[model samples]
Target: MTALSERFTTARQEGRTTGRTAAVRARVLAYVGLTKPRIIELLLVTTVPAMMLAARGWPSFSLLLATLVGGTLAAGAANVFNCYFDRDIDRLMQRTQKRPLVTGEVTPRAALVFGFVLTVSSIALLAATTTLLAAALAAAAIFYYAVLYTMVFKRHTRRSTEWGGVPGAAPVLIGWAAVTGSLDWPAVVVFAVVFCWQMPHFWALALRFKDDYARADVPMLPVVTTALSVGRQSVAWAWATVAVSLLLWPVATGYGIGLGYTIPAILLGGWFVVEAHRLLARIKRGGDMKPMQLFHVSISYLALLMVAIVVDAIV
Candidate 1:
C-alpha cells in the first residue's frame, strides 16, 4: 500500500507538470501570433537590403542585427495595434477571423498593452543601437499605420491604400538612416520604389477579398470602384513602381550600383508590368483575374529586386 501510494503521487505530479507545460506553450504561441510574424518577415526583407546598399557592402554584423531587431519590433507593434482596432471587422472576414483577438486567443486589453510595450521598446532600441533619425522614423511608422491608416483613412476613404503606402515604405528610409544617420534624395527614391509598389500589391489583395471589405464596410479601392477601374489603376501604379525602380539605378550611382542592377530592374519591372497587364486583360474579358496571382508575384518581385540591389552594390 505504501509503494502504491508513492507511485500514485508521482504520477499525479507528472500529470500536473505536463499540463502546466502545455498551458505555457499555448500562451507563448498566442502572444507571438499577435505580432503577425509573416508581415514582419516581409518588412525585414526590404530593410536589410536597404541597409546593405546604404553601406555599399555588408554592414557590421552588430548594426545589421540591431536594425532588424528594432525594425521588426516596430512593425510588429504597428500590426498589433491594427489588429486590436480592427478586431471587430476581422471577425467578419474569412481571412482574419482566426486572428488572436477574434478567436479569443488574446484579449483586447492584453493586445493594447503588448502594442504599447513593443512601441516604447522598439523606439528605445533603435535610438540606442542606431541613430535618433532611425528611431524617429520607426516611431513615425507606428503612428502612421496605427492612427492615420487604421483609424482615419481606412474607414473613410477609397484612397487609403495609396496613402497607407507611405508608412509601409518608411522601412527603407529607416534602414538607410540607420546606416547614414540621415536622409537624402537617393534614400527618397528608394523609398518611392516601395511607396509605388504597395498600390498594385495591395489592390490585388483587395480585389481578392472585395466581398470581405464590402461586408466590413471598409472602403478599399475594389470595394468602392468597378473592376475595370481597379485593374487600370493597378497597371498605372505598376508602371510608376517600375519607373521608380529604374530611377534607383541612376540615383544610386554614388553607391556603386551599376548596369548589373539596371538590367535586373528592367527585366523584373517588365515582368511585373506584364503581370499587371495580364490582370487587366483578364478583367476586360469578363472573367476572373485571380488577383492572388499578381499578389504572390508582387512579393517575389520585391524580394528579388532587393537582392539585385545588394548584389549590385557588392559587385
Candidate 2:
C-alpha cells in the first residue's frame, strides 16, 4: 500500500510539471504572436534586396545583420501597437479573432508595454549598428504605422490603406540608407514601386475581408465601395505599380541594373496587371472575384521583382 501511494504521488507530480511547461510555452508563443512576425518577414523581404541593390552586391555581413534585425524589431513594434489598438475590431473580424489579444492569450496592458519596449530597443539598435539616418527612417516607419495609419486614418478615411503604404515602403529606404548612409534616386524609385504595389495587394485583401471590415466598421475601400469599383481601382493601381516598376529599369542604370532587371520587371509587372484585370472581369460578370488570387500573386510579384534587382546588381 505504501509503494502504491508513492507511485501515485510521483505520477501526479509529473503531470503537474508537464502542465506548467505547456503553460509557459503557450505564453511565450502568445507574446511572439503579438509582434506579428509574418508581416515582419514580408517587410524584411523588401529590405535585404534594397540593401543588395544599394551595395551593388552583397553588403558587409555585419551591416546586413544589423539592418535586418533592426528593421524586424521596428516593424514588429509597429504591428504590436496596431494589434493593441485594433483589438476591439480584431475581436469582431473572423480573420483576426484568433489573434493573441483577441483570444485573451496576452493582456492589452502587456501588449502595450511590449510594443513600447520594442520601439525603444529597435531605434537604439539601429542607431548603434547602422547609420543614424537608417535609425531615423525606422523610427518614422514605426510612428507612421502605429500612430498615423492606425490611430487616425484607418478609422476615418476610405483611403487609409493607400496612404498607409508610405510607411510600408519605408523599409526599402531604411535598408538603402543603412547601406549608403543617405537616400538616393534608386531608394526613392524603389519606395515608389512599393507604394504603388501596396494598393492592389492590400485592396485585394480588403476585398476578401470586406464583410469583416463592414462588421468592424472599418472604412476599407472594399467595405465602402462596390466590388466592381474595388476591382477597377485595383486595376488602375496595378497599372501604376507596373509603370513605377519599369521606371526603376532606367533609374537603376548606374547601380548595374540592366536588361537583367528590366526584362523580369516587365514580365512580372505584366503578369501582375493581367491578374488584376482578371479580378475586374470576374466582378463584372457578377461572379465572385476571388480577390485572394491577386493577393497571393502580388506577394510573388514583389518577391520576384526584388530578386531580379539583386541578381542584376550582382551580375
**What residue pairs clash in candidate 2, if any at all?**
none
Q: After superposition, how far is residue 260 of candidate 1 from its true place, in Å?
A: 1.1
Error of 1 at 150 (Å): 0.4
Summarize candidate 1's per-residue lDDT along 1-315 as a digit string, tens digits: 999999999999999999999989998888889889998898888888789889989999999999999999999999999999999899889989989999898899999999999999999999999999999999999999999999999999999999899989999999999999998777788889999999999999999999999999999999999999999999999999999998887788999788988899999999999999999999999877899999998999999998998899898
- Every candidate's lDDT: 0.93, 0.93
Q: lDDT tens string, model 2, 213-238?
A: 99999999988889889899999999
lDDT score, candidate 2: 0.93
**Against the hidden reference, what TM-scores do the models get?**
0.97, 0.97
Those runs of model 2 whose alpha carbons end farther than 4 Å from true positions after fitting are: 1-3
